[model samples]
Target: MDEPRGDYWYNLVTGKVEVGAQSDWTQLIGPYASREEAEHAIEKVHERNRSWEQGEED
Candidate 1:
């Protein structure tokens, strides 16, 4: 069974890692599976964008 837990979020404005929503939805990045992953959310997004631009995801 799935258990409920507080999700992680990256606040774009303050560049903070939150255990749950503390800011407006438009200013956050995620509900990442883990805190560590959420902490690197921006880097992850940038990496994915780079891969896509280079067709590395193909």
Candidate 2:
């Protein structure tokens, strides 16, 4: 895959941290500023879900 110029991405289908968009948009989860952020994408999603469940807003 050709590296796109942008933030890192987390490929949900492959569960991998990519330099940018490396897969279909539907299968990717980020324009995260860093690879570390992309790596924790799932955790962030769960955190948001839990916060929403508790009626919390950022």
Candidate 3:
């Protein structure tokens, strides 16, 4: 039998997405096709990370 590709998850600790058969310190939110895709998602989140912080203090 062939090994499955399995599900990929985003690694918040490493700040990079990885695919494998392991989950613990890593967060398995969902799967992404490529690292670029995952990075883009992270970037989007970061873009908004400071929005609330800045708004409240302003």
Candidate 4:
């Protein structure tokens, strides 16, 4: 059997995952092993973006 690859979450803006190889920042999103994990990460990105936007309004 093939070894299972672990899931990873990539930042949309920074293009860096919590765990993974470095790559072109702009082109990085995810190599997640499952869709749920990817969705979770995306939620985080959205939360951060919202916070930043709010901060900018201040």
- TM-score per candidate: 0.75, 0.76, 0.45, 0.42
Candidate 2 C-alpha lDDT tens digits along 1-58:
7544458998888899988686899999979877777899989999999989888554
Distance from true location, Cα of 52 in model 4, Å:
0.1
* Least well predicted 10-residue stretch by lDDT in candidate 1: 1-10
What C-alpha lDDT values do all the predictions have? 0.84, 0.83, 0.61, 0.64
Clashes of each: 0, 0, 0, 0
**Candidate 4 lDDT tens digits, 1-58:** 6424564657676644545535664655777775457547777778999999999999
State the local distance difference test value for candidate 3.
0.61
User: Which window of ten consecutive residues has the lowest lDDT sum in model 4?
Assistant: 15-24
Q: Give the TM-score of candidate 1.
A: 0.75
Error of 3 at 6 (Å): 12
Q: Rank the candidates by TM-score, best first.
A: 2, 1, 3, 4
Q: lDDT order of candidates, best first?
A: 1, 2, 4, 3
For model 3, how does the per-residue alpha-carbon lDDT over 1-58 read when each residue is reduced to its tens digit? 6323434557766666666625674455456655556556666667788787889898
Candidate 4: which pairs clash? Answer: none
lDDT string, candidate 1, 34-58, tens digits: 7787889999989999988889646
What lDDT, from 0 to 1, does candidate 4 have?
Answer: 0.64
Predictions: Cα RMSD each: 4.8, 4.3, 4.5, 5.7
Q: Which regions of candidate 2 are displaced past 4 Å?
A: 1-6, 56-58
